[model samples]
Target: MSSDRRDFVLTAGKLLVLTAPAAAYLEAVETGKAEEPAYKMAEHYWGMIVDVDKCIGCGNCVRACKTENDVPVEPYFFRTWVERYHVAEGAEHPDVDSPDGGYSGFPEKYAAGDGAKSFFVPKLCNQCAHSPCTQVCPVGATFESPDGAVLVDKSYCLGCRYCVQACPYGCRFIDPRTKTVDKCNLCYHRITKGLTTACCESCPTGARQLVDLKDPKDPVHDFLRDHKIQVLKPQLATGAKVYYNGLDGSVR
Candidate 1:
């Protein structure tokens, strides 16, 4: 490990001990000692659910995520963005657009009662069980956490865009500042501390929810069982963990 990696591991260990009551989990290759680690990888499995019916095209989630994660305000660096779809009656494909990643909310593109239905679909890293990005990463900088969140170790990242190209959702991007491939991590640092993701916290109508599928009390279980849900690209068999309710056929 490099000096930066060593320092990070040491800092994480210190934070872990100070926040024990939170039951947070964060593991690194090594710091200095072989003593017992604080993280319990098996204790949780993380995921998210987006309710299309609840999203109002308000752009609150997008703005909150950008601010909280320090994602670049530029168009190409979105860790999470909302797409607005306008599906005409009996149309084969919807006119989809996410101008500036919908950071400033969507403008009135189509008039009301214009023979088209409009809705918003938020997009992010799927945290796939069989992620192509993770497979193609040569340095193993991008990895699937034991708790199921796909994360990146910037220190170990080689700044290769393989993971960026591998993602079908267009979620991964090269951070100009770090030159490291970046994507949604479900706010791993916050979630591990028992707090919800910034996006979820900012959603005005509960459009997004950060859930731990492994937790019986997480409510995602019943949400999945109770709702008619679908993954973004189920045909690829990515084992994507992000679920969506009322997903439209027009979304691409």
Candidate 2:
């Protein structure tokens, strides 16, 4: 199954590189003959926004991400996951848990009479502008793309876990099959062709949105300006791009 999956990816990559949409970019990178690169790094800046108030913890996003990306089937391995935060009344901290990486949905842990407010928080790579993961790579295998996406060059990667270690969000992981670090890249193959990431596409509640900060006409500009947003671990100052709305103060 893994071999077949890898073959599919290989075929898809080749087809993508040769297709009309990416032909010029391929020529520029592979042959250095194109007058201009097809996808300019400066033309786009990508990010995501999550409305905590809208998330339902249905597991659609998690399931879609794993299937779309061919992620391994293990509780510990996830490109994107969801955490169920149960904030007890008058408590300083919330109880957080993600069973099976929230792949199969959650059982009711709190009752209506439990006096706890429960919400779901989806988690993934922040794609930070000043990412600590990018800073710690011994090799340039992991890089922040010119278009503001954090991507990995699997061919150049040495299977080191430095990038994984430096990530504060617990986003990166070393793939047992490939022996290489892996994580979400906002579904670059899809996004470059004007498609949304799998998680965003599959979210049932419209809780997630792919945001483009560089486009003046993009709705993301207005959304950011209007909403009171927060990023995880602002104290680390990684310049995280993922924004959260209606985030509970008890969230870690």
Candidate 3:
């Protein structure tokens, strides 16, 4: 192990008791055997591009995320979910719902030619550069990673739920198993290994795509320059990294 890695492990161990999996991960890193141990965090500024128009409400992404991250099966606890927005003609606000966090495909609620325009909006952690969750976390367990994903160290988390309340996007939830605040980290484990997120991988229509903002050759640059993309709740100015194309104004 490098001196820095050893020091980090030692410091982290001192802060809290490491779980078996966490301990094994530390051991792997010390031995230079961890998955993608050599990943250069500094080289990547991670984000995501969500093509709003392409999402078909298939619920494939939600199911894939749950399977990949082991999210709680119960309703209202999700690392990622999809919401269906129905805007009645001439209505100011849209009626939004996510049945089972959209784990199962949405049922047909509105009849054809009902004068309601409905669309599916997939939701996850914004991965904000100025994240309120990190600020509100008293124990420093919730933090933004160097590579731009907001993450939580479960061992250090106090399960206080402060971060959950501070989040503007309602993306966080308390894990039933661990009793800790949890949200999407953009599949940090897979991304560090140069693989796409499970949600992105499962989307048959390619609605979600993992992006590296700092890479000059990355196609995200072209997409951003060519398309008029917007972040959810841009008025809050959270510096959210996730960009949505073809987003409707009525979405919340």
Best by lDDT: 3
**Candidate 2, residues 84-105: lDDT per residue as tens digits?**
9988889888899999878999
Q: Provide backbone clash counts, one per model.
A: 0, 0, 0
Cα distance off (Å), candidate 2, residue 120 = 0.3
Deviating ranges (above 4 Å) for candidate 3: 1-36
Clash list (residue pairs), candidate 3:
none
Q: Work out candidate 2's RMSD over C-alphas.
A: 13.6
Q: Better model by TM-score, 2 or 3?
A: 3
lDDT of 1 by residue, 146-239 (tens): 9999999999999979998998888899999998888999999898877899999999899999999989998899999999999998998888
Quote the lDDT for 249 in model 2.
84
lDDT of 3 by residue, 1-252 (tens): 699999998998866775777888889889877655678989999999999999999999999999999998888788889999999989998999889988998998888889889899998998999998899999899899999999999999999999889999999999988898889999999999989999999999999999999999999999999999999998888899999999999987
Instruction: Sort the predicted structures by TM-score, highest score first.
Output: 3, 2, 1
TM-score, structure 3 vs. true: 0.86
Collision pairs in model 2: none
Return the TM-score for candidate 1, rounded to 2 decimals.
Answer: 0.84
Candidates by lDDT, descending order:
3, 2, 1
The TM-scores of all predictions, comma-separated, are: 0.84, 0.85, 0.86
